[model samples]
Target chain A: MRGPLSKRLFLWTLVWAVVLTLSAPTFVIIGASLTAGEMLQFPPEGLSFKWYRQLWQLDDFKHALTRTFYVSLICTLLSLPVGTLAAIAMVRYRFRFQGTLQVYLLLPFTIPLVVSGLSMMLFFGDIRVLGQLWPVGVGLCAINIPFMIWSVSASVNALDPELENAAANCGAPPVQAFLTVTVPAVMPGIITGALLMFILAFNEFLVSLFLTDSRTVTLPVQIYNSIRSVITPDLAAVSVVFILIAVVTIGLLDRLVGLEIFLRSK
Target chain B: MNRTLNRKPIAWTLLDAVEISASTVWPFRGRAAVARAFLLPAVLVVGLLLVGLGYIIEYSFHELDITTYRLKDEYSIINYHTVLERPVYLRVLGRTVLASLIVTFLTITLALPYAYVLVRTASAAMRKFLLFALFLPFFIGQVVRAYGWLIILGREGLINAAVTSLGLPTLDLIYTYPAVLFGLIQYMLPFAVLLLIPAIAAIGEDMELASEGLGAHWVATFRYVVLPLAKPGLVGASVVVFTLTMTDFAMPEILGGGTNDFIASAIYDSFFQISNPGLGAALSVILIAVGSLLVMGFFLAAGPGTLGFRSRV
Candidate 1:
């Protein structure tokens, strides 16, 4: 408490040490991806962008990337409205069995991905909807809705209901008041929820593995299959890109809403 | 003023209509309609997942013909018995539980002092930077992070390189128990820090000062004062880390190197590789049961009305 300069220096050093330690892997992968020689040799001799270029050229990786983007995009879009509605209901309503409803809504988050994947596989297979892209989208949407609900609900709790009441009193319809007042008030929450849902869907693998056909194979699934079948610098290259996307997304979120609020809500 | 007056009457008419419909249609009608409209989508999704889970549970107890690759209508407990009686299944289950516990304990231990420092430090910039560093790894993709560890723990990777540079004999670590543990602990440490920071911040500096003024040693103050107050964060963080590690497939699959397997990976293999849906379903049920029990046990141990009780207060 007495010495400010030294304390700051010490704290900075500690932070730098931890960050450097954790970031070593990211650097190593990037270096390995750029290695001129094959076979993932580290200290990765004579760097080049050959592997990265090679990975980009692969049709499967390209298709998987596109599929992953589309699926995550669709899931995020579908989940936002649904999750926002659920959050509003949970926060605004005080009905019987509301607590029970909240628990049920959170059940998807509690269930393991493997179980969810397997269950979806069986259920969809029985209904003849297995091996379709829509089911894969639905599975991702189901898994992501709870996360969106929680985040949006936290923000919803912070909103003042008086604005909506004022609008309604001023000759606005209920839907119009909600659209003009509540929705704008909760936009930050909705954005955060959408970001989370997108990331979850993008990174999802187990569910994709069960629910996706060839037409719907996601990037994570493709990388997973590649890793199992063959060890290549291309997979490492693809992982580098994936990590970059995640890092950029998080950095953007930190800039937009602050990291503390996001973590605190969780 | 005239336009406003005209719109007001129209809006009033709409409200009157809504009121008439609400009163005539049913009791608590307006609220019921609003609630239903809001709750319908969430309830439908939850219902779908529950139905799927219900089917999985039903399938778990039935017999599937190996030759036909079809489910037999006749019910049997053979899958559950097989899971219970087999040494492999039992060993994997025990190991998964043990590994998760170890990882959770390690994460809490490593994160506690770090979180304490982050929250108690006076400098605003330092706190921001520290928190950012802590959350950075979490934002990165899990598979990429796991692969990062694979490189670090590999035969000629960074750890071994450092050891040889220091003139020490290289230790074989990758694909071993230590690798798995290290990967899991690193993966979960950020979560522990995130959870602990708020609780630590909530304690403030006055309590620590008071304890020290009362001549309590640092260790005594931390054990008796800080920890008890931080119990909620500890419980929440531990519950999350334990459950995630318990159900995790990628970490154990990549690091365990055929020498180890968690129940998640086993379930994956049964369903996809072996095509034994019944056995897979049984494994899944067991996994869920174990995870739920662990969470419940943590809550009970932490006491009623504490953290880990429920998401909401």
Candidate 2:
């Protein structure tokens, strides 16, 4: 009782208290989503999955969910190669403008997503040659590539260059060496980057709001519309679904790639 | 080349093999060359988009044509003038900046002990639990998290229920400025922790041990040693949290309950609700200026820890 155990215990309690307080809303929402009552309430009135059933019956929810998945998938597919190449270059090369290039690649991180969406709409809304989601996809791809670069580049940077060199020295061609050796070394970061991109694109709303029409509404926008207008506890259920999906995906990711690497934006 | 091509008059496979072998034997197999070749397409695309942002800047200087719903032919600074003249824009901007700053401060204050404990604790199970807690909300995205707040902080929400059940007067908690700020703080707390963990982890145990040995209290040791060492991360998180909260549209819209419009909301209203693209562009330009200036100020004040770019390469 007299040692540092007390101090450590106090700190541990304080930390958990903060964590629990911050996370309470999410838990409450999940519980409220399952309530038998129509209105949202915590320690819910009764247990029921009525909202989930109702959410399943909505056409708008279905369309938005499908659109969100499809668009996020497309965004991930387009950005992975582009972002990976850029990440590899940023990591592998040293040139006169290396620093400048790094900064340039990362500038999108600072721009408000709302501003990005508005600007893209201003520039491309006039084209009328393409659909709304296509431009939204492009803008998302743009914002996401830099993040992709940052994430994938970390894995690339962590690699020991000699492993690739050894493959090359064994008479493997550059492409063969890269594919066989470098790819394995950097696969984790690439996968993590791709997953992050998918999640981000799937969840992105501000940019989607600016760019997507009612015809092209994504899930989050759909959710927002429901919240602003009329919707059932189905939304609360959807929110729970979002939380569950995020928790599971991130839990798997925490095991695979380690969420710690996100902080090492070196 | 001539010998390989001699039998390949119409043989594409032979030509492909010959081309591949040529590349295999080519000189100057350098990383820079490969990187340059690979970086070309992405750089071009992203750069062109940046140029598109430049076009928006140009549009901000023009008047909107209500007839055609486009920027007018003649350019003017009248959009900028209107922005400056309207106190609402400045007020919203100020509110955004203030709320962002408040959130940043609260996040750091709340995150510091958590990060310190996570880093210092020898127990793996505890660390994993803390990490799990941190990543769950981070993965949920801003919109869902804000909605979570909606259910909990609503007029007849849980807190109010708890209050009224206790014979205490219920307070107007949701849909106020503080409510939006409260949601922003929660939304940003994870990011702040993620940034701070790295910095705190970098601080060696010896420094703290040494400080304690030298007759310093824990707070004093933290003030002198830990805080100084953790500056890079704090500044980095502050910039990120600030910029994010300032440009955020989702939190304010969902949690603000239609009255507490931040800059991003203002921009959205200008473009869509008001249908003044020029005014929207102007607001955007100003927002960018505000964000960029804040970033630049922090970078100059704190040195190159803004993004904490590694000079390793």
Candidate 3:
């Protein structure tokens, strides 16, 4: 709509200001990571990689990094096929309690994360698996599988039903037809869902905090410990690493399917 | 395909065996069976979580024995009673709700115009830039972002360093109630914006133009046309931001500096510090109840499609 120039200018300015404020923390963290002198400070005394280099010698950080990868990989693997199947059923079939099932699939998400974490912790304790790392992966998978279903459902909804029918018409059985025809068509959705699940699992903190023991601590948990116990440039260096991964992932996501897929999946 | 499979006899045999076994085992002719098979694995995962919630409900009725670090065998309402009776618990609950409401209000207000411009701007470049900035922090999880705030707002951090150099006293910016709220608003802003974009886009530029053609001012158009059209998105974004902020664990823990505790922090302390699982379980049940109530109330008022779900049933 047409408006006064001054009014339009004001709206743009406010938008830009809010955008900058949203990004300020990342800029500050990166600047602090580059400090030449000791201590975390933005607008560093001089540019140096001392903190980044220091990270190599920290065994705790290294172990936490490996554990994080392990957990996230497990989370992705567990969620991927299950979520894909759920998506296919939800999108391609008529079934009883279909809408109720859809909401039930998102149950882990609707429950507060803290509540989920604590409940899982207690449940795992009862089952005698509280401190094991794989259960943490299981917990992460449960919380994140809904994203997988939603993402894959977007693609399943887009698939041409006639293609699968054609495969069947060619004397292919249902399972073979599905494997050959439907899977490739929905490959993009599967990949997107996997990427999102991996990233979310990698970045998960609260659930990890509740379920992990000292030996099984994940990267985010280690970062929390560092924040509470020590103020170091090393922490800034780790944060810079997280920021870089996020930047790279966003770039990849944009290139692969465009960023709007995120809106669709949500 | 035939030549390659002929050259790899083992692969061809395995594919045949798998297809024959599949047709024999499940007989995908039954469509309901196929659908049930497809749904069973995810339902199992959901089943595990439901059992966990069951455990929480069960544990909430028992009392923890601090000396033994084990809950009493006899189920009682003592844990819930303590949560309701304790002044500290009451205070934390009050603060969490108050802060969540404030953060939800501010995040939605800030997000609306940003979403509008991104959706309505004629310039593609401007829209691209806004999406990048919005999604940047979004991909960076809450814990890392909160840590970033620590480096910027800490005592010897950026703000304090600048303040001291300017011949002014340093400020204690981090680890306060307002600091927690500030961090939460920043964290929730992107989510609000993302949720708002689809709703705002649904309004389309034509509606705004039509209103203007009818001689409505920009403000009047925004109020009468945009606001009413975007109600689902606004409500959706508000509910999301509010519930997330209400149960947030990182911001208050990281920025509140051990003084301004939210309900999540209290739950953490009970379970880990005091070794009281029963109390923690009680708090979790309360939190779950409150969150479900809010969501159910909204679903009643705005419908389930607010979150962009298609109501297939």
Local accuracy by lDDT, each model: 0.77, 0.79, 0.85
Q: Report the C-alpha lDDT of model 1 over B268-297, residue by residue, as the tens digit.
A: 888778888899999999888878887778
Where does candidate 1 stray beyond 4 Å? A1-21, A166-172, A263-266, B1-32, B161-170, B303-313
Tell me the alpha-carbon RMSD of every candidate: 4.0, 4.8, 2.7
Tell me the tens digit of each residue's lDDT in model 2 across B1-313: 6786577555455545665886876655766777787788678657646866876788889898878887788989999999999999999999999998898888888888787877877777777888888878877778888877877777777888888888999878888998898888888888888777777877888988898899887767878998998887788788888888889888888889778999888888987788887888899889988899988888889865525334233
Ranking by lDDT: 3, 2, 1
What lDDT tens digits, residue by residue, belong to model 3 across residues B1-313? 6786558678456767788898788755657878889999999987778888998889889898767879999989999999999998989989999998899999988999998888877776777788899988988888899988888899988889889999999898998999999999999999899878867877767888899899988889889999998887898788889888999999999999999999999988988898887898899888878778877897788865446334222
2 or 3, greater by DockQ: 3
Where is model 3 chain B poorest over a 10-residue stretch in terms of lDDT?
B304-313
Which scores higher on lDDT, 1 or 2?
2
lDDT of 1 at B98: 95
Candidate 1's interface RMSD, please?
A: 4.0
Question: Model 2 over residues A1-266: C-alpha lDDT tens digits?
Answer: 11156566766787988798678878877777888987665557789888888889989888888888888888888888888888777777777788777777777777777777766665676666235566677778887787687667778878888988898789776766766788788888888888888888888888788678889998888788888865357788888867877887787787888765654523
User: What ranking emerges by DockQ with the best candidate at the front?
Assistant: 3, 2, 1
